[model samples]
Target: MAQTATTGTTVAEVMAELAALEDPRIREVNVRHGDDHGVNLTKLRAVAKRLKTQHELARELWATGDTAARLLALLVCRPKAFERDELDTMLRDARTPKVHDWLVGYVVKKSPHAEALRVAWFADPDPVVASAGWALTTDRVARSPEGLDLPGLLDVIEAQMKDAPDRLQWAMNHCLAQIGIEHAEHRARALEIGERLEVLKDYPTPPGCTSPFAPAWITEMVSRQHTP
Candidate 1:
């Protein structure tokens, strides 16, 4: 791995480090996660720790066309440096659900243009863009829902969730749960919609994990909030 004395680590150095950490078992796991080009999360984190934030380096890494490299790019890219067009490009280029989730959660949601992008993306025809939009909406509702139109969001979920793409459906269901848990005024409506939509009602969850069905998940989260 080449390192500049002044600039620290370059993208090439990080790529070399990632190449060194490649394992067949790790690659198999990554393939199952929808990554055709694989590197383990542990190695990715190790590289990120060593390089820290490097926006320019991230851009270069993204261009290398490796799934792990792109995931690392999302980690290191400066949100402030992102433009809407660039974000759109990244979302389109994301080949896996894991990459799409990270790009939306880690990069797009933190950008200054998040709200505008969220609004535009939710209506987008591309399934990835639409999924990210709902995911962004869920994040906003969970944190600060100052000027958002909650009723409108609920209406959309109720109307479109049934026929939506798999990724978008998951995010929309999550958005419904966030509304029920975070906004007391909308809790009843959100739960009602949850029952009607029955989002993930039959989906299997781990033994100890709460189901992601909005009504159940909302009830659990609200109970926890009041318990302490």
Candidate 2:
């Protein structure tokens, strides 16, 4: 029997530990690491689905175990890429607060999926869930065009905020920041969320170490905000 090695910090060391997984936990942990390192997006998404239903897959997910399932589940749903049922299933089983945020962030970036995303968001029982819902709403507001209905989206988010935790304000506002509101009503809702978050200063983060939104999106949001 091999004893588990205990002192590796680099990703390579981590993979070696995983490959040696006489221990089930170690295997799951390492699979999760591959995701953290640089596995392909579609492959990761496939792994996430298997983890959702299969024990062996779950073992692998747990190996990388760094929230790869959550990240992949969210990535699986994207504009022009995601279908509603898949998104629905992802949200339905995503008990982790961070997974909920990942779903919320993904939904906001998409154009046609808002209503379905709205349904799942409300279904989440956690206050963090509500905040993710609220934040995603802000995104809808941003991309909503001349003919799009802003009032409806605002109505949902505002109603959700009533039940959501105050700590979620920052995430909700950050969602708005991505959208860059245009509709007058949504603009106000975006501002309201932003102001609330700014005042509170404490955003409710989901479980796990990774960020929820895409790297490029963050870069764009920051660049635009900083621009004159």
Candidate 3:
């Protein structure tokens, strides 16, 4: 087991801890998800718990460009403190899936710049950036759907999702499922689109895990919502 940070919280010490925690097996698993880190997330979060929030330290750790260290930095940084453009730059630099996921889920989602960035990245030439935009859109679909063009979103998914790169395809599939589960008005069309496109239809889902195939995912979630 790697030692938890009980003493030093400086970049050098935290990075040393991260390097010490690396496991070849963990890296092997993470590589499948487009990540390159090996530190267990539970231990990383434990380290963050000891260090608490140190936004400046977070920046320095992120500057190191180490995957585990950036993951740690995300845990310790204040989300709302980042400028919009700074977040954009970080997203552009975050090429790995885990780092990109954490940046979007932990920081960008909480930042006031979320919507602006969502709109900006939605049509980005980079599929990875567009995937983040779709991820943000999925959040909005579930939480606040007031002014979003549900039909237009469905149209876009119907048109582009099948041919999108892996990450963007997954994100679009999520948005499709969210629309189907949350809005009864769009449920039928969402399911219909999913069935017609056949995206992720053959994906191997682990036991008791819902398929990322959109129609099945939508049906399972919607069923759970109505479960007694």
Candidate 4:
């Protein structure tokens, strides 16, 4: 007989197959969960709805003692539990570096609302989060007509500033490079940020990522800025 899935099983049960609680478990479940490139997003939505309503499942993502389980659970929770309140909850209580990376990247690459994502991004307790969150504002300029706050983000990551991470400086500069493309006045801002990155091409190394980078856009800006 073929192994049959339970009809009455909860969506969580249908999706999550927990191995014994251990570091190795992430590898096991990750393969199983992410195996199909097209994940069953429908079922994931159901599970997220359940977790959003049930504190216990949500708590497991943050409060549970099982580390691997907790990370897996949070990973699932991201696609499913993206409501503003749910994200706020995770931002407030979830401290795992892995989870923060997932959340921040999601907000940067996927969110429909750039401003809303900015709010969620700032919720991270880590300095990396704060830096990335601030940098994200510039990242959105490429996708939005309202444009990015390049000077602000660039200022925050300034090398001469009181305290700044070299990685963040790189990242913010990268984002500025992307913003340079628009036929808008901010092209100057973009070149300024790109020149910053070019300066760092010889630096020892950096910590966090800089902002976004759009090579085509940066090239355009360089050409336009340099044209006599």
Point out the higher-scoring one by lDDT: 1 or 2.
1
lDDT of 1 by residue, 14-60 (tens): 77878887788877887886776567787687777777778888888
Question: Would you list the clashing residue pairs of candidate 3?
Answer: none
TM-score for each model: 0.91, 0.42, 0.95, 0.49
Task: Please identify which of the two predictions, 2 or 3, would achieve the higher TM-score against the true structure.
Answer: 3
Worst 10 residues of 1 by lDDT: 1-10
Off by over 4 Å in 3: 1-8
User: What TM-score should be assigned to candidate 1?
Assistant: 0.91
lDDT for model 1: 0.85
lDDT of 4 by residue, 1-228 (tens): 122132333434533433322234444554563331222334444444544444244344445433344444554443443565655555444354444554556533454443675756643545555545655655565666365445664554444322445444444555556556643466665566456545444444335533234444466456676799
Rank the candidate models, highest TM-score first: 3, 1, 4, 2
List, residue by residue over 98-194, the lDDT tens digit for candidate 3.
Answer: 8999999999999999999999999999999999999999999999988999999999999999999999999999999999999999999999999
lDDT of 1 at 97: 76
Q: Who wins the TM-score comparison?
A: 3
**TM-score of candidate 3 to 2 decimals:** 0.95
Cα RMSDs, all models: 2.1, 11.0, 3.3, 8.9
Error of 4 at 225 (Å): 17
lDDT of 4 at 99: 48
Which runs of model 1 end up more than 4 angstroms from their true locations? 1-10
Q: Candidate 2 at residue 71, lDDT?
A: 56
> What C-alpha root-mean-square deviation, in Å, does candidate 4 show against the real structure?
8.9
